[model samples]
Target: MRRSVLGLLALLASTALQAATSVRYCDYPVYPPVSWSDGKQPRGLAPTVVRELFGRLGYRVEMVVLGNWQRCLLDAAEGRVDVVLAYTSAQREQTLRFSKVPVLREEVAVFANRQHPLAFNRLEDLARYRGGLLFGESYGPAFDQFVAQHQNIEWVSSSGQNFGKLIRGRIDFVIQERRTGQLFVEHLPGAGDIVALPPALSVDYLRVAVSRRSPLSAHMAEIDAQLQQMADAGELERWLQESEVTYRDMVRQP
Candidate 1:
């Protein structure tokens, strides 16, 4: 009877360990000042915020870097991953459950080569020149509709490639978030030749989204409660500031 009781206790402990929730958080290769992968590892603002939020929630997180933004979204949508850090959109709401509070406000801006400087006071002004864009990114509803209607836009896989093309006079301008564009321009080889235009093209909120198929789906209320608490306590802003400083130091490294 003593031996049987000991064996039953061991079985219960094993089952408890197996039931612990583990989340696979997917991120794309590049976004910077927001989120990016260093080829082998993930880094940047979003990742930092996620680490704090989920770490405190007691969930085991495994960071996975998908090839691109589209892949990251796809993985999250299909429930292959537990979550994805992304910009919130009406379309995305159909696939993932977004956090109640946003992690950051993303401001998209136009970038042009210094030699062929360009500026636009309105969206219509952009129609005058050819532009380069990432393969599967949306600036916002208005800009996205504009890009779809226009035919001169070129698509590239990476910001580095877009900047390279812009420097070679292959494209008239490239659109990206203000801070991200600045970071790329400051670090890319022909740094001095690229510049971001004044005023922003669009501003959107970015948030953490949990996959519908994740086991954590049942705990959405609790997850959002923690996020709201962090926001209320100003912890989210502090994380963003810390991330900005860290990214600046990384870019300045030799």
Candidate 2:
């Protein structure tokens, strides 16, 4: 009887070890409608889609909403998390593996205080002005290079802070995602004075990046397959719609 019990215990332990694994990812707080934190963990469309995708693959998700975007990337580089659901940049490609199919499309825009209309026709038009950008953010490779070489941009902690600085005349413009900026305009105090300048700066694709050092890096193909299916089924769009409405309600005044 004792021998039989020992064999059964070993079998159960092996089965448990072979069960579905848990995958952890990073999330930037205050990036509403796409990524945000409820002060406890990451919330918004990005986390929603992450949970759905990982759930489909039978993996439990753990969301890490640390300090800021810079902090999140640092953790990713150190292999502290398994994935980062964010916009792709040249620097990120070096340390992480990305799926060819994008997870979401984001429009980058320059927001100016309505009281101070900007005569911005292109990236060059803003050379004289100072802009606020969230820390560790990249609009894309081309614009990022332009900013690096020509533009005067100040890095800050959150998009909300950028908007605040813009209203206070501390910065000339705020570079932010169009949708999230709209949310801030509608939900945040004094944000009503902001307007997104026409002619988007860049149309970016948000993709899930798995850390190269992570064991799950081997599952990129599988992850992409599921992402494609989710896109085909219109799940991503539906989730965006739902997430935006939910977020607005959360921040909107009664």
Candidate 3:
């Protein structure tokens, strides 16, 4: 009876270990309406959807909020974190394995002060004016190349700061994700003075990426299957819309 009990205990332990897949997910501190950390807690749309995704996969997530976008990238690349919520880029693919299905498609746009408004039909049209962008954020390959060649574009830490610069006429325009910029405008003081301009810069799909060095790398196929299921069932879209409404309501509260 003692030997039988010990064997059963070992079996149970093995089953528990197989079921408990601990994921260390990291994201930047501020990218409102998408992903952000309120103090130590992860909040916003991406986190909401991510939590649901992993929950379905029978995995436990421990969020690690970094101080900046660069740090998040570095931590994921160095295997300090298991995964990161990030956009796929050619440069990043070297060290990170991206999800087969994207979580969301982000619409990138240009915003300028209402009083000092500027218009652009093409990428080259914006070359005459100064611009602001978040440090380490990428719009797309073309825009990234454009910003790299231009000296007039300045990088700030957050969208709020860029909007402030735009309102003050310190920068002629700022490029950011439309929904994210709108969220910042709704919350930040004096942000009402800034408006999104015509012509979107780019539309990039965002995905959850696991570090190449992570032990979870072998489970990429299973992760993609789960993501595909959510997409097919339309749960991903519903979660995104629900998260946006929830966040808006939270911000409006007294």
Per-residue lDDT over 8-113 for candidate 3, one digit per residue giving the tens place of the 0 to 100 score: 9867644553465777888775777787555558787777767777776667888887767788888889999988878888888989999989988888888888
Off by over 4 Å in 3: 1-20
Model 3 misses residue 164 by how many Å?
A: 1.4
State which candidate has the highest TM-score: 2
Query: Ranking under lDDT, best-scoring first?
Result: 2, 3, 1
Give per-residue CA lDDT, model 2, range 74-153, as digits (tens): 78877899888777777998888888889789898989998877788888888888899888888878778878887599
Q: Which residue pairs in model 1 clash with each other?
A: none
What C-alpha lDDT, on a 0 to 100 scale, does residue 155 get in candidate 3?
Answer: 83
**Candidate 2 residue pairs in clash (backbone atoms < 3 Å):** none
**Clash number for each model:** 0, 0, 0
Instruction: Report the Cα lDDT for residue 215, model 3.
Output: 71
Q: So what's the TM-score on candidate 1?
A: 0.86
- Estimate candidate 1's alpha-carbon lDDT, on a 0 to 1 scale: 0.80
